[model samples]
Each structure stands twice: as structure tokens, then as C-alpha cells.
Target: MPPAPDDRPGPSRNLAVDFCGVSRSYGRVRAVAGLDLRIAEGEVVALLGPNGAGKSTTLDMVLGLTDPDTGTARVLGTTPADAVRHGRVGAVLQTGELLPHVTVGELVELVAALHDRPLGVDDALRTAGIGDLRSRRTTALSGGQVQRVRFAVALVGDPVLLVLDEPTASLDVASRAALWETIRGQAQAGRTILFATHHLEEADTYADRIVLLARGQVVADGPVTELTGATRGRTLRATVPGADLDRLSALPGVRTAEARGEAVVLHCTDSDRALRALLSTGPSARDIEVTGADLTDAFLALTADPPR
Candidate 1:
């Protein structure tokens, strides 16, 4: 059966994809239930979760590859699967099932031909960061190279909403960073993007917003800041030889005190207050390095069991 229609009601007036109380099951297994989400036009959102957390299921529903048992998934004002049939959506699944017999250039041309209107081969190659790989046969390319080719294919059609499922799953660190830039560029060009990933730090750094899922449920959803809201503030990591970790933990306004090598990571509720207190402690306090709470720490704190 085809996925649900994309004209479902949404929270935003400009939502590109909106899901309302959506549920999907596999007989005895309830993979996802009552998941409500709204992604606006031109916004890049990351769906983050552990294995079996329903990340792939959600993407499949959005891309029209899987039908939801109940509720609806709307893509750009039409049904998801129908939208794809109309050439309104493009997606790159984790496994890029490109035709092994075709050359990258040939497959690209074929895809571009599907749209009466499409960006040319030269443009598509340039945009996908694989201009040099065009002549290479799909069978000969490295896993990372093939993923780029898949990205090219997904982008060649020029759909309004691009859904990428673990596009960087096979890529090395550098390739992943480059793809992040590519996705960011696309978002800046006014295309809405929804990608699922387990790279916690990458999601924090690159996503305009993040949706946290676990055990096939929408445990949390919002901008990185929204989930990381309460964890905001300054941090002080100091390497002090004379200090007692227990004594430092007792200091006022110290959110957390952990030993990092010989240094103590002291996250502060207020930098000014913490800095003043540190200075009064000793001359070695000058070694205290003040920093901000980054997304990594925020992610850990939010997903941590103690938070909720």
C-alpha cells in the first residue's frame, strides 16, 4: 500500500512535511505511535535516535516507501507516495541501490530526463561534489563515492523536499563534513531537508533543529537549543594540582565538577560568579579556561536519564 497523503493538517502555515499522531505497526510490534512533527519550508531538521528508534520508519513514511497503519504523513501539500510519483520529493536511502550496469553519467542523464525540467549534467555533477566521478562506472566506485553518486541522483530531479537517510553512513569523517556543507547549501537555496543520523555531534552542529527518538517513540523534538535549553551557560575547565575534586564540587554555582585528565571540568551556572570564586581560591585559578556549553554536552544532558 502507498504511504498517506501529504495534505494533512500541520502546525505551521509553511510546513513542508507534517505528521499528526502518526502510528505504524508490524502486527505485534508497535514501531511508532502518535508521532507529531512539523517541518517548515527551507528548514533543515535532523531526526536523531538509536537503533530501532523508528528513525528509518519515519523517513520511509515521509518518502512514501512505507504506509503508516494509522494517521497521516503529508509532503508538500500532497500524499507522500503520490508526491514522489509527481516528482515533488527526492530521497537517498541508506543503501543506494543504483543500477550496477550503468555508468554514473548514464544514470544521471536518465534521472534528469524524468523531469521535463532539470539541471544539466555539468551542474548536477558540480553541485554534488562528484564532477570527476561522472565517467566512472557504478560498480568500480568506492562506497563513499557511490553514496555521492546516489546524492547526485536524488538531487538531479530537483524536488522541493529532500529526504536523506544516513547519506553519510558509509563516508569517512571528511566526506561527511563535506556532505554537511552540501546539505547546508541546499537548505540555503530554499530546499527543505530531513535526514536521520546517529552522529550526535554532527546533528548538533549541522541541524537547524533536532528530533530525538528512542525505543520507537518521539522522546523529544525541537531545535537543539529547545532540548538543550536548561543546560545553557558557561563552563570552566581548569588543571589544578593542589585542588581537591570534592572541595571544588562543593563550590557555589558549580553545575558539575568532573576530572578530565589532571584538569577539573567545572560547568558554571554563571561565568562571572564562577570566575570570581575561582580567582579567590588561588593564583592557579588563572589557568581556568572559560568556555561555553556546546551541543555535545547539551545532547548528553538532554538524553540522560536524569533529565526527565
Candidate 2:
């Protein structure tokens, strides 16, 4: 989820975010390769990858915090810097030290004041689920609370494009879910959101689209369903007590089979064939369930690289 590298060409007058042949590197390591991507208004997109995958670098370009060595990063059809200056872009970066002395309310209010057109401090706080904590000093809040406060600071600008870099890292399940709810509300109201996350479920459940980055390039791009089904297969789970694991693994259409306690799980290239074979051979295979491959499966299949 570190800094990395997209592309599309020409002026996309109405797109929320545009990256055209964008590439950035540090010394000999290319963080982002030539990449092009376009995000429409009101869409929730996730940039997904592992460490050093260039997710952060790509976001930095979009936020105008770092210049691309080649190509351009645009927000709302303008340079990221211009859009940021006009309060049309807001960002929550992965790492930063919050100001020590200010109260949460004061912090949000200060950011709101910087924008010519800004959301009210109270409104931002409410949207970020931190309205009650507004009076707490920045130094006094827990890590999760502090993160929500940072979200409030970004939301105070009422930006059209919200860019977040690993916004939910290290939070407990409850905190992550809470933050996602606030994000979902913001997106529902027509703001375009682009967030980078290592959590596969976050990308699969929340994003309208997923851009899978590996080593500065996109290994996959599409809807969650499409990516999950990228392997052209289905998964079948069935309860078969005392089943013959070796026989199940040898089923004609099944690519792999494993025992999950009292159940047998099958990854199959042909579901119809596999199902028929299972029911015919394993008469005891009951409580059958069929589902497509999930994002985690697809990610491993697609991003598995050859040994260097």
C-alpha cells in the first residue's frame, strides 16, 4: 500500500479523476508505470495492492502532493493542485501527526475556514461520526477517534473528489465498520471517492470498481464480481461426513478439493460437471452450496508472480 503508480488521454471534461500515462519512480525503482484510469462522478473506487505497490504514490499524484515524472493527474478536469486549491479535492493520507494542542472542533473549523466554500464544522463532524467528540483535544483521543477527526477535517472542505490512502489501517472491526458507514454516506450523496486499502473485503464490499496494483501496474480492473470470477470457475461446498478426500479431489471438473471438517470444498472449472459428478459419486454429499470465487482467491491467482 505504499507509494506507486495510470493513464487515459485527452481532457476528460467531466470525469472525477483522470490519470494519463502517469508514471513516477524513485532512483532506479519505478513506483508507477505508464498507467491510465478514469473515474466517473459519484463512483466509489478502490486501489488495492500489497506493500510497495504504488497505491500511495498514485494517490499523492492525484492530490498534487507529488508530481508525476511523466503524464498528468487531474481532478474535476483540472490539475490536482488547482482542484485542491478550489476546495474540490480532499484527502486523508495514511500517515501524519495531528496538531497537538487543538480541540477536534477547532481543528475541523480551521480547515473549513481555509476553503472559500466549505461544509460547516458541525456538519463535517456529524458526517464523520465524531460530532460528540468535537470538544475533545486532539492529544486526548484514541487512535480510532483521531482518525475520525482527520476524516472530519477532510470533509469540512466539501470536496467533490475524496482521496483516502489506507484510511482504516490498524483499526478494530467496529471502528473500521463505522468509518466505512460514514464513507458510504458521503458516496451516496454523489461525491466521487477513491481510497487505497489492503483489506480485500473493503475493496470487494465497498467499491464499485477495483484496480488491483502489483509492482506499479494494474494486474486487474473491473467490478468485484468480475474480478472474483476472473479464474473462470466456481466454488462448491458440501457436507459429506467421512468423505473420501482423494476421490473428491479426482472429480473430473474439480480443479482442487479439500476437507473442511465434515464438509468438502471444491474449486471447479465447470460447475455443472462437477455438481453432477459429486452427486453421482458421493451420494452422501448433502447440504451442498455453490458460490463464485471471492476477491482473495482472484487476487492470489492474478498477482502471483514468478520468482525473481
Candidate 3:
């Protein structure tokens, strides 16, 4: 007997996700506006935006939890819902209560049973770094442990594309590190990963590319280095007791100055000139370090509000 259409593999495509002219709204608020994005297969892309900036809405559309009012969203060369039904898309969402009274292993097994080509329960648990927690009840797990269980559930499907929304939320430093290590391994295995995170450093370090949303649209999209390099300035940090921020801001090369305790941070177009001026003046700056703009700087610059 032949397999059903849905049971067959999707056509091969270089892009894992493609959204064109997509828009969505709730009441009078527009969540996403003509957003066009494309993520290549095997790429680890970070989706970044402030609260209410449409990150969640966009992810929801991709997961087929919500439909766009216009345009289209395709995953794995098919509609999002179709891809999901074929067990080609897996997600680790931020919200949702685990099944009560079920052991971690049981919950994972149950999810795996729904998929046509799910990974082994033990393999999923091991991949998610929760092999030992299989016997623990879901209700008895810690926040981090619950997150790991969610990861296991998502991995059980062995999806071609993974969507993670705040995957490291509620996790401690060590747990966060462990989860990212697993994620990196999965990415290396040729799975496409799309994750949204508030941790700027995580995106800066892990993502192969970044797509930043603002006011329901893409404001910046590029490699981490490319976006940060576009910010076009150096940040100088130095210890200057009783620093006068106004004076520092007035420096020929300085664009802005902010004081943090005994240290003053200067955003400068010309760090060499700024450093010379700072030292020549009375404050007696010391322990100076000048570095180029980073992801945080790029994010702030790109997401700032537009003038009326």
C-alpha cells in the first residue's frame, strides 16, 4: 500500500521558513505588519524584539497556532499547519502547563506516539539532558527540570525545524549553558532553529543570523557581526571619580556619556581623540578600555522609536 500524501516527505528546499507580506492583527492592534523573512535550512536564527514587538505573534503564525490576515507563511516547503501535522516542526513555547500526574518519561512517550517518525523516548530524553529525570513526575520537577522535559517532548518528534520561545527562561546559569550546548549539537546536525530570547548575549553568541523586529516589522536583519558593526562607534569605559557626564559628552568625538558609579562610559566616533581629551582634562581617568559596539548597542539603535 502507498503512503498518504501527508505521510510522504516534503519536497527539498533550501529555505526552512519563508514568510512574505505577512500581517496579523488583534482588535485595533497590529501584531505583525507586512513582515517578510526567510530562514535557510540548517541555520540558527535569533528573533529579537521588545515586548509587544510581534515576536510571539510571528512565532505563533509559524507554528500555525494563528493565521495571518494576509500573505503566507511556509515551513519545509509546505503550509505551516501541514508541516506541523507531518511532524516536521517542533516547538518549545514559553507557556503551557505540563500534563499533571504524568511522569516525565510518560509525557515524552505520549507526545512521541503522536508523531509518525518520532525519535526514541530514551534518545529524546538523553538529547534533552533529562535522561535521569524520566522517573520523576512532571509536577515534582523544578522549573528548569520542567523546561528540560519540554525540550525532550519537542525533540521526541525529531522535527526538521525547531522553534523556541524563551527556552532558557527560568533556568539558572548552569542549566542555561547545558540547554544551549544541546541546542548547538542539534543545529550542527542540520536542523533549522529559530529561537526568540531576551538574553542578548545568548543571541550574540549562538545565532548564525539575527532578525530584529520593531513596530510589527523587521528593523534589522543580518549576521551578529554585521549588525553590531553597523552601529558605527566605539564605547569607552573608564574610572573617573566624580565624573561630569556633560563635560564628557561635550568632547569633540564623544556622542554620549553616561556615568556608572565611579566609571563613565563614553560613546565615541573617535576613541583615540576621546581618550586623549579625557586624560588631558582634570578628572584623571584610569583603567580605560575602548571597544566597538556590541549587539546590545545595535539593538538599541535599531529599535529606537521613530520621530513623530
Candidate 4:
């Protein structure tokens, strides 16, 4: 709608995706609205949003199962449907979408055979971390195990672009970490990967760029550092001489200030900003310290939006 991709310097120079006011709607509910975005090659972008925030819809558009009623989605310079058949694009959708009656091995082979040159059954299984589950029926595998099979399907094609929608859902922390490692391995292999998830920390810990979406539109997009800022004002303990920490807590954008031991640990938007305010509090200010706000604090501050 807005980008007018056909009017640009063609797909080769444009972003991996060229969405100008792209949107999809069913009846009165708009799953996605007029949205414009660009994803470059080899970019690992994590889509983060609340439930029903259109994350799944966005992935579907990228996968070509659902087309936008308004605007369009281009995967790696090609329409998602054509991209699947010709361009390099892979996706593990929310539904798993596995053929229940087939053994994992058969499914793997079927997908691999789609390409003129595909990975060996053994190699796909090995790469997908499901070598041991080759003979298992797709319907019988555990969620994590099935998830691995889904990856095997997406990956066996050797697509240049990979889309994972909530790839770590229903996984425990350990499983989630293992899944992350696997995805990182793919990224290391230089695949342009885009994963959608609700977990901020996972996006922070794994993705190269965090693309935040809300209410059917992109709210923020950038490297973790760019979105959060330097230092992130780490969570630090500050020992101050004052009992009235409310003045310190009330500092603008200071998320929380709690007294611990002889100091206080503050979670805030700008740790530097918070630090400066705490230091100026009359004679009661003493021993002000600083620490780093991990991804949580950074994400919290970045995604913060005024009430609509």
C-alpha cells in the first residue's frame, strides 16, 4: 500500500521482505494492518508481541498459506507462495502441520526430495537432532521431538530464509535452550532466519534483531543494543544514606526501586538517568552505584507504549 515495491529498484536491491502497508483481515477483525517492513538477507529477526498480536498471522503471510487482503509479503524478493516453490524459504508454522500417518523418516525424505539437491535422510535427521527418532511415527512423538521433526522438514529443503513461529512453545527451559542452540547453529550456517515468539528474553538471547509488533503494526525494529541503548543500566545495588527512597523511586522512568541491605536495586528505563537523579537527592544520597539491565529491562523499556 505504501512501499509500492514494484516501483522500487527491483527485489534484488530491496530488503528480504518489502511490505508497504501490508495487511490481512477477516470480517471486522484485522489480523494485520497496513504495515511496512524490510528484512535484509542473513538477518535473524525475532518477532515479539502479546497474544493475538498477529505474530502467527504474519508468519502465515510469509509462508503463503494466508495472503494479505491489503498490501503484500515478499520472502527473499519473491512472493511467499512462489518463494516456497522457487526461492529459498523455509518455515515451521504454529500447527506443526505434519502428516500424522507417516513415519518421521518418510516425511523427511519427502521434504528433502523437493529440492533438486537435498540432504540425505541421515543428514537431515542428524542436523535436525532427530537421528534417533527416524522410525517414530509423527503422531507418536513428544512435542519437543515433533518440533524437531518440523525443523527437519523446514531445514531439509535448505531454504535461505527460515521462519519459525513460536518454535519453543511448550518447551521447558532446558529444551528451550537446546532449541535455541539448534537455531543458532542454523544462523551460523548463514541462513536468513526469522522466528516469532512471545518470550522477550529468548529474542534478546538469540535473535540478531528484535522486531517488536503490537496492534497489527511494527512498533520497534533494531539490533538489541540499538533498541535498548548502551549499558542498559544494569541491576545494581546502591547504598544510600536516606530512608526516603520514594524520592529515588519516583524518578522518571525508574521502573522499581527496592531497598536491599545497605542499598537499593533499581530496575529502570535509563539507568544513567536514574543514577543521576538518585545522586542529587540532598545530603541523603551516598554510595550510588550502577549495574547492567539484562534483556528484560532493555525490552521492557523499549516496548513501553503510552496508553491509547
Clashes of each: 5, 13, 0, 5
Best by TM-score: 3
Compared with the true structure, what per-residue lDDT tens digits does model 2 show for residues 64-142? 8889999877778889889899999989999897888989998888889899989988899998898899888899988
Model 3 agreement with the true structure over 1-308: per-residue lDDT tens digits:
11233432233537788999999999999999999998878778899988889998999989999999999898878899999999999999979999998899999999999999899999999999988998898999899988889888888999999999999997999999999999999998989899999899999878888889998999988778878888889999999987888988999789999988888899999999898899899557788999999889899999999888
TM-score of each: 0.81, 0.87, 0.91, 0.81
The regions of model 4 sitting more than 4 angstroms off are 1-14, 230-242, 245-289, 292-294
Candidate 3 or 4, higher lDDT?
3
Q: Indicate which candidate wins on lDDT.
A: 3
Q: Runs in model 1 with CA error above 4 Å?
A: 1-12, 26-30, 113-118, 200-205, 219-222, 225-227, 267-286, 306-308
Which residue pairs come into collision in candidate 4? 234-291, 234-292, 234-293, 238-263, 239-263
C-alpha lDDT (0 to 100) for residue 249 of candidate 2: 81
For each candidate, the alpha-carbon lDDT, in order, equals 0.79, 0.86, 0.89, 0.78
Residue lDDT tens for model 1, 19-117: 888888878777887888888777778898767778888899998888889888888888898888877788889764789888899999999998756
Model 1 weakest lDDT span, ten residues long:
1-10
User: In model 3, which regions exceed 4 Å deviation?
Assistant: 1-13, 240-243, 279-284
Ranking of all candidate structures by their TM-score, best first:
3, 2, 1, 4
TM-score of 3: 0.91
